[model samples]
Target: MSGDASHRPLDLRSDTVTRPDETMRAAMAAAEVGDDILDGDPTVRALEEKAAEILGTEATLWVPSGTMGNLIALTVHLRPGDRFLAPALAHVVEFELGGWASFAGGVPHALPWSAGPGRVSPASVRASVPPSQPYDALRDRLLCLENTHNAAGGTVTGPGEHRAVTATAKEAGLLVHLDGARIWNAAVSLDVQPAELTWGVDSVLACLSKGLCAPMGSVLGGSAEFVRAARRLRKMVGGAVRQGGVMAAAGLVALSRIELLRNDHSNARVLASGLRDLGWEAASPETNIVLARVTDAERRVSELHRMGILATTISGAVRFVTHADLSEKDIQEVIWRISSMSP
Candidate 1:
């Protein structure tokens, strides 16, 4: 996606592929580092504090990755043998390598979802809970939601959806954990403060590495007590970075570039439109991800890669993601190339 070489094709694989810009590199070089687990790195502390403020939470803890952040939150929220509810395609259920069952000792209960990618409803939440009989276990103790849902093609979870589903979950005595790895995209698409999107959730995970272009870092935010427990779980799971200031420095730079996400959203829309023009069924993107229907998705992904465009195949569709590295011109070029591709 970079202007590295004229022959290089546009890389719409994933936003995670974005390389840190010069500003981020400079910040990392000049970072004020410390023994993070021992003495507390000032940069890491600053990043956590800023994340807490942004999410309107009492405290936050920095983790090496989004998966770790999410698992830590789940571990803190649920006890062993407990079950949690989430949409069928939620990353925690489908993508997390069964960590909820393995490490958190939690069982996943699937909820009905759809391609609108906004399928978690108040009714669905109520349905997840069983009748409160004395003999009933009421195993469902948590509810997980994803914003700008990845497998559903980066569709957004609007504030209205947040209120309805979260309120219902709380009423059913279920704590909510938001998998907000791409909440930045949902915020940009909805034109709302990030806090507004996360309000009412018991805990939230936000990533600096995706779309924001930070090399590595994700933060989980919640009440002070929740974060305190999450910090212990963080170390228990081997996520305690000793000198994490280098990554935190880039996270600071990433926060400063939040406004630019709008550009990626715009590019994603263009890619979707192009797919439609090419006779493929492409979902209208609400953020930086485009999921286009492909007759042979797996084969098409390989072909696209050979053609110099990298994309991912998921659930019988090809997913194209836009990021800081790809330009508007790059999107157009990719479209033209796809149009000329053989049937």
Candidate 2:
């Protein structure tokens, strides 16, 4: 954050931009590793156990990305003709490449909640399925919920809301999976453990890289048998890793930095308030992501980069993400840069 501060680009592009610091690198270098495929890597096992403990699941498996983790959960829950349900704008359906249909052979059914875009009520979820169906019918079978929903401006689904939806799914005999890639942010913002928001769900996935600042990997946690099946599915999808403890050592450090996420949430709120003060309408972020209304978002993002303030164009708005790598000085610099811009 010092020395040539003016030359540094305010990279509010995404949390994924963060690079591992010295402590993480040191852990990675000092990791005890082995062939993870044949003989499991000791550090990877430790990290997986830590992830399971954090998520309050029976077991956990380390995977390559959030997409693969979610996909594995999907394929494990639904079959070829089964119907899967999720919020209309969920990353699993929108961002991930039709993996349910492509890999799992399941069909997708989008259900939007009455409260807003990223929520679904018990009644609504119940209504999405049939009251009575014939034996020949292939009915809705799975539900996936995204906390701190990406396209919905990172809005959180509290434990109550999460339970409301999941309760309905349970009544309908439907399995549930949580796309909790940003659950750490939600937990920090809500002042609750991540496991509290995930109760009753069959499976859950959280990323180690985003906001957590690990260079790579995501962890999927669920019942012991669910994780065992996921491991085979992971291997089938070419996500297997040997000597993975090297990267997992960084994840071990990432878990230790959970409390630090509050800073990103704080920075996000500050950035949102600053944008509003400067006349751009920005959503007050509940977590680390800020979605702001801007004229010509593509042009604004380009100009922001020109001014050394980096962002992304999302849903016709300029998206600014706060991360562990961004310091308070960086936030102020970004605000100054934005205030100086015409857009």
Candidate 3:
């Protein structure tokens, strides 16, 4: 980032910063809500049903955020002291403040990213399980996978690998949970149904706020029995709501526009390519995140901030994320400004 270094506002931090559009705001205002915890919110139920159908699950529960949804799945799948495996730098292990351990009472195991960036091999999943022991052993009970993995520059896990790894976990008597916070991006990038990436998982969570432009909410889907248990866990974790339909309304609108993420993916590639041409080591992104390796992360980030371009660091790389909020022209302008920055 060298040259003029002039201020030109653009935010490439995370897709979660996307704001609801007018249609979503109107839907939220008009949404028919009820006491979700006491009785039930009709709009919330509608969002849950739509999410379950999209994810190919028996049922769904709307939660306040993807983190809570993942935690609920973890608590439902594991007993205290049980172990769960996830890919290295998975949000479940690294980003969620250790709730899997502190709240779900499960031990965490990180599998290497041998399959690819943000992907774990089926062999690794099998190898992670402990063999029978003479004395008490740490039970490996769950395998968690992330789609459009965050720290890996939003790298995607394809449907075939998804099925293979989930099958391996099942064979090893381990339940599968997918932290699909950005599954919408994976589905669009792979040209596959979201369910294709989630097949065979005991539980899967998808975020409404990420790339969907919803204000907030995530849907957790699974077998009816599993969701029945998750509902109890949700309340236990203080995730239950009263008038959640306001948020669910925006989620409904967001789902209707999921195809829009294709533009974000396109913009991300353009940003990475542009940055690379400007002497930055920007990785070619698989989805909407570009991880550019730079000399001084903190200093370069501060420089980017001075130019009014926001970004965050992940795995020692500067990460720039594209979302519905940004257009191709905006991305080009961002690159132009970076190119204009002083050396």
lDDT value, candidate 2, whole model: 0.90
Model 3 off-target regions past 4 Å? 1-8
| Best-performing candidate as measured by lDDT | 3
Q: Write the per-residue lDDT of candidate 2 for residues 1-343, one digit (tens) a residue.
A: 3334556688988899999999999999999999999989999999999999999999999998999999999999988999888888788998888988899988888887576757777887888899789989887889889998888888888888888888889999999999999999999999999899899999999999999999999999999999999999999999999999999999999999999999999999998998889999897988899998877999999888887888998778889999989987689878877776765
Candidate 1, residue 140: the lDDT equals 80
Query: Order of candidates by TM-score, top first?
Result: 3, 2, 1
Clashing residue pairs in candidate 3 are 2-341, 2-342, 3-341, 3-342, 4-340, 5-341
> Which segments of model 1 are wrong by more than 4 Å?
1-6, 133-138
Total backbone clashes of candidate 1, pairs 3 or more residues apart or in separate chains: 0
- Displacement of residue 239 (Cα, Å) in model 3 is 1.2
Give the better candidate number (2 or 3) by TM-score.
Answer: 3
TM-score of each: 0.95, 0.96, 0.96
Cα shift from native, residue 101, model 2 (Å): 1.7
Residues 64-161 of candidate 3 have per-residue lDDT tens digits of 99999999999999999998899999999999998988888999999999899999999898788855644577888999999989998899999989
lDDT of each: 0.87, 0.90, 0.91
Worst lDDT run of 10 residues, candidate 1, spans 1-10
